[model samples]
Target: MTKRRALLSVSDKTGIVEFAKKLVSLDFEIISTGGTQKTLTDNQIETVGIESVTDFPEMLDGRVKTLHPKIHGGLLGKRSNEEHVETMKKHAILPIDLVCVNLYPFKETIQKRDVTEEEAIENIDIGGPSMLRSASKNCESVTVIIDPIDYETVISELSETGNTTLVTRKKLAAKAFRHTASYDALIADYLTNQVEEGEQESLTLTFDLKQSLRYGENSHQKASFYASSIPTAFSIASAKQLHGKELSYNNIKDADACLRMMSEFKSPTAVAVKHMNPCGIGNGKDIYTAFMNAYESDPVSIFGGIIALNREVDAKTAEKLANIFLEIIIAPSFSEEALEILTKKKNIRLLALEMREQKDISEKEYVSVLGGLLVQEMDTLVEDETTWKIVTKRQPTQTELEALVFANKCVKHVKSNAIVIANNERTLGIGAGQMNRVGSTKIALEQAKEQLDTAVLASDAFFPMADSVELIGQSGVKAIIQPGGSIKDQESIEMADKYGITMIFTDVRHFKH
Candidate 1:
């Protein structure tokens, strides 16, 4: 009978000594490298070093130790082949039955505030990834472990059955490949960003699973939540769910929309989102007024929608929020009274997230299209009247200007062919995802009703023709704001002048599809 051999080399020493002790108890010889050897030997567990197996000392700052053929041939050889066993006997190579290895902490090191290129480059692991790949490729005979969380399960199975099943080995092998692949991707993305001129032709993205949802957008589909590996303060991935049921796919999408819309305002703001579009948004002297204004914008649309506010939710605001059947409510914090009032509703989800200015964590956005991907830089540019071009005879009044800015912010989050009509920092009506500009205008105006006379409209993009302007003018809207880049821009401006309306061109277009 021959003793099975296990190789253990890990940067994270979590539960390694106990796991090694379990293998020793199972009559397995443990071979380790560097700190792993030191820790195991210190814990009264017998272990052999890589220097003994390869017959060479670790050199070149500890990079050349595990690249020897003796180490790799042992991991890559097949036990099913008679010729493989004969060759191992001829070369004095011992087969490695199990490999426990984890790569360097490149992702965590690069996340520091002042990490340099030299520091990041030095943290990239070489021998660790090589060993993992070799062992994973020969998973028919070798078991590979990359995550420390799986140590207890693997140990328990080995102790009970004297070996891991083939199915468990295959699954662990797949996980090992993904672990090394993600580690390499982080290094690739970091180096590419160092170039000052242009971006890399290909995109490398990595996300860690935050939680698995009960289902996707539909109950029949599967779903899970993934957070960007890059760190940032203002993301749903990092939000804390203070109470209520688990989040669904639709809840996450709508909550993100509400947060983006809430980021547009400096004052106390509240935004209500439905189906990934802003149904109502408002700002006021206090968060209570903001909540009521946004809720009253379109009460029917706000039902079952998610609400996000920029300030701490108070008892008054929580009372109003609990009045309707809502899906989720997210804010920076909740007052004691507010929590008491809102907690009464057992099923409504309450999330607490401190809002911050969103820095460019990743400057690019990727969308899958058919067989390939479409990539573009994120739209983080802030647009205001500083670069606006007012194209109408009657300039907007002070009050109208404020309303126009608010409406523009609300419109940016709406789908294409979107129209948002607002008054006194509160959205009066919103028409989103329409086929044509006139159709959106009619829906927004119809929803505003008597408020149309004093309400202002914001277009997400330029109106190609004058039909939308004429439609809003007939509805008695006093002011309009849009991006003016159309060939018939003069026509739209003339139409605005004909009806004695104020029109401003932001020169920036925000088209969200």
Candidate 2:
């Protein structure tokens, strides 16, 4: 009987010596290449060089080592087919029972601060993927292993039964394909990022599973979290949880919304979110004051919401946050005393992020439809007031201009058909996702009833008709701001002029779906 043969070529040399020793103990001939063979021989484990099997030396800087027909024939030959056995025997090719291969650290290399395009290209593995695919294609005759964590399991199975089960081989084959696909995606993403204008017209995105969540938006729906392979500094996927319970699906979604809202302000800002919409948002002299102002925006709606702070959490703010029934709190950092006080709430999830002065936004945003994807550039353009037109006769005061800009920023993140009522950099009422513009105006007006006379209202888009303008004007909305692109813009401007309401046209629309 022929002794079992195993080929090992890996960049991550984790537990290779012990695994090879176990295979040698099982009466298997260990065939290895380059560093793997050197390590195995250094550890006194018997092994044969891969060149001995191929009858050729590794050349072209180790790129042409495993593309030989001898290696692939051994992996792909079928033992049950007599013709394949005859062909293999005629070529004097011995069957390889197991293949253990892992690619180079392409992802790791590209993450280096000073890495160049040429360096990234050089790290891409060629022969490693070829051998793994050949073995995976003939999984019924050969076992393929790519992850180091599976070494013990394979050793245990071979020790007990002298071979791996078909089920195990199939599962490993699936993982091998996933591994290669992820590797190729990383290479593609890196190259795409380096391409200049007019060179490539599309982007390739890939996400690796980060973790399996308990459920999706609802408890009954299954879900998992996948993160971009390219590293980022400000994404919620990379946040470090300092204390408290694991974040749920809803918690992550709400936290992301809260972060985006908070990112709109340069000053110390706070945003509270519930059900993927901002319940409250404010900027103040300090983070604690900002938190208080945001909480005051809507005390009832912020009860079980997530809070995001753009500054470090101090002891005073943490004490205030502790009193509320918040599901999550995300901040740049936390004072030691603040962490001590906040950790008392065992169920509240706490995350710490590194605040960046200018966060990088990806160019494309994808929304999945029934049978396709709706792709668009990210809505990251800054609204320039210099480009705005003051259509109404009355010019807005400095205070009104500040309030209008603040409200406009807040409304940009709200759902479509949105209206936001704000004053002094604080959101008083936000009506979002309404079917009609009048309905949203009514909701925001009612929420800011007490402050309507002093508040400025911001409409995410032009009022389709003059009814929305009439509604806000009658409700004592001191000023109004909108994109002003509707064909009936004159009608809305006339209504604002009639009511002496200051109106400005940004000439830019922000319609969030």
Error of 1 at 32 (Å): 1.1
Instruction: For candidate 2, give the lDDT of residue 69.
Output: 78
Superposed on all Cα atoms, model 2 deviates from the true structure by an RMSD in Å of 1.5
Candidate 2, run of 10 with poorest lDDT: 196-205
- Return the TM-score for each candidate structure: 0.96, 0.97
Model 2: residue 193 alpha-carbon error in angstroms: 2.5
Clashing pairs in 1: none
lDDT of each: 0.88, 0.89
Error of 2 at 221 (Å): 1.0
Model 1: CA > 4 A from native: 196-199, 361-363
User: Global lDDT for candidate 1?
Assistant: 0.88
lDDT (10s digit) by residue, model 1, range 344-417: 99999999988755554335667889999888876656785688878889988999998898898888889988
